[model samples]
Target: MKSFDVAIIGSGPSGASAAFELSKSGISTVIIEKETLPRYKTCGGGLVFRGLKMMPFDISSVVEKEFYAIDTYFSQKHPCITTRRKEPIVSMVMRDAFDNLIVEKARNNGVTLLQNHKVVDITFGETQTIHTTEGDVTAKFIIAADGALSPIAKIAGWKETRTIIPALEYEVEVPAADFERLSNDARFDIDAIPYGYGWCFPKKNHLSIGVAVVIKTNKKINLKEYYAAYLKRLGITEILKEEGHGFVIPVAPRTDFFVQKNVFLTGDSAGLADPLVAEGISNSILSGIQAAEAIIESQLDPEKAAVLYTEKLKTGILPEIEKAKVLSYHFYSKKSFRNIILMKYGQYAAEALTDLFMGERTYPKDYLKSITKKIKDAIFF
Candidate 1:
């Protein structure tokens, strides 16, 4: 058995981020990836500025587009609102390239990279054994960053604790006219699908367009139908692909995503996507960092490590997720999202959201203070 200080499963944002940080900290870590590096990954491919700010190194080579404004629609084009900022709030990149950037960085930092390795089973104890097709690896700590529907998390008996929702996306090729026309702006349309939303993220040559919905939330509406309608709304008739790729995304961050037990869950495996936007890359990266910190601080004491990791989670990501949960139903209900969140505060809210994308503000960090002051001002002024 090959023994290491730490073992990470899956090489997406979370796993790669953890490996990168651990190596930088001089911790011995190895990442066991199920597939080869630079593989294609299904995503909206929008790297929010907040996510970008978390990167220690520059990825300008992978960035396809940087937009200064985000255009949102309630329905079709009616009541369309545009939020503009002084700087680009979101940058676009293909997942294959984006993930490769982080993974390569970790490799360069002295982290061992094992590709084409699928984890079949994991034996947990003081020393964890990860049995893979390639071989078995033993480590004092394990980080499960495999993604939603994570095999590692399920084998670890975490299947029932996390709830996953369905998400679908596409790399659509349209006519030159349409591609050029739509490429100028990025669009986020709410109610594009029942209990969900749709987006159009323009790339170098095509627009990655799709719709997503919370699983089991709306039984009557079909996501495919919504996706077709969304394309029609955008006048993208020349779809190069017949059927888009479909996957499950966790809608809310799991309260127990960080359950210690000498194993930690990061990224979608931990259900860390935003409840409102379903944006996850940023939080997952941050969780990866926090998990590394906890592991170093506890230094192989499983019981103590679990407690400290849980505490770190509660303060770091859990609070943001909790606040988002409260805001979810209300924000998505009866168009209250527009009335309460966007309208009540108006440009101020827009700026705040822009700040959110810029990593200037994080959920629940300044969430309570901002809301309390807004309420006071609404009543008295």
Candidate 2:
């Protein structure tokens, strides 16, 4: 078995970010990926500005579209809110290219890349030994960033109650004329459907259109049906290419155990996804960096490292996720009220809501009170 200072499983954004951060600190690191380079991942491929700021390197090369406006619709007929941001709020990119770019950066930074290697089993003793398809490898520390269904997390006996949000996304090519007319100036639109919402994220040549709905509900609405309806609403008929893919996004935070002995879990494996938007990429990257930092700190002082990891989650990420869960419950429970609030508040509220969604600001009790006031004002006024 090959031994190293750190062993990272999975090559997604989280894993790659951890590998890069550790390797750059001169720690011997190895990354094991289950798939080949440039693997396709089922995702909406949207990157918020705050997420981009957390990366160690520049990613301008991988950005597909820079959107500064958001158009939200409560129903298919009318727009609820149209907000123009002063700065670039979000960027859209294909996951294959985006993840591959980060992995390549990690390789360039001297992290050993074990491509096409799947980690089957992991044993923690004096050191950690991971059994992979290629071979077994040993490391002083192991970081599990293998996503929602993380095997490493399972082996470590980390308990998680994941709220899976089923999403079906597609990339469809529209005629040049229609694309030009229908597409706003680098803006993304969100249309609230019966069970969930539909979104349109424009790329270089095609549009990333999708719908997401909560799986726990009894509403068995087909996403493709919504997609067709969305297209018809937009007056988009001609399509060059269309491909639909579905993936599960965890909405709630994991219970408690994200770290065990010599193992640490980051990203979706720890259920760090944003509950309000179901966005995981930024949170995954942030958690990975935090995990790497915790590992390094733990190496210096083991007890302090463990304490710091827990503290980081409690003070850093968990609070935001907790607030998001409440917001998500509110949206899904009383969607009409949420829609009316968006319509009445318009862009200022949208921007603040966007900040809340991106985890840039904490949701205070007063903010919720203000929302209630707004609802009352809308009713009375």
Error of 2 at 34 (Å): 0.8
The model with the greatest lDDT is 1
User: Model 1's lDDT to the true fold?
Assistant: 0.80
- State, as a TM-score between 0 and 1, how close model 2 is to the true structure: 0.92
lDDT of 2 by residue, 239-267 (tens): 88899887778777778667776777889
lDDT of 1 by residue, 318-356 (tens): 777767766666556546434544545655655666777
Q: What's the lDDT for residue 118 in model 2?
A: 87
Instruction: Estimate the Cα RMSD of every predicted model relative to the unseen true structure.
Output: 2.9, 2.2
lDDT of 1 at 23: 86
Q: What are the TM-scores, per candidate, against the unseen true structure?
A: 0.91, 0.92
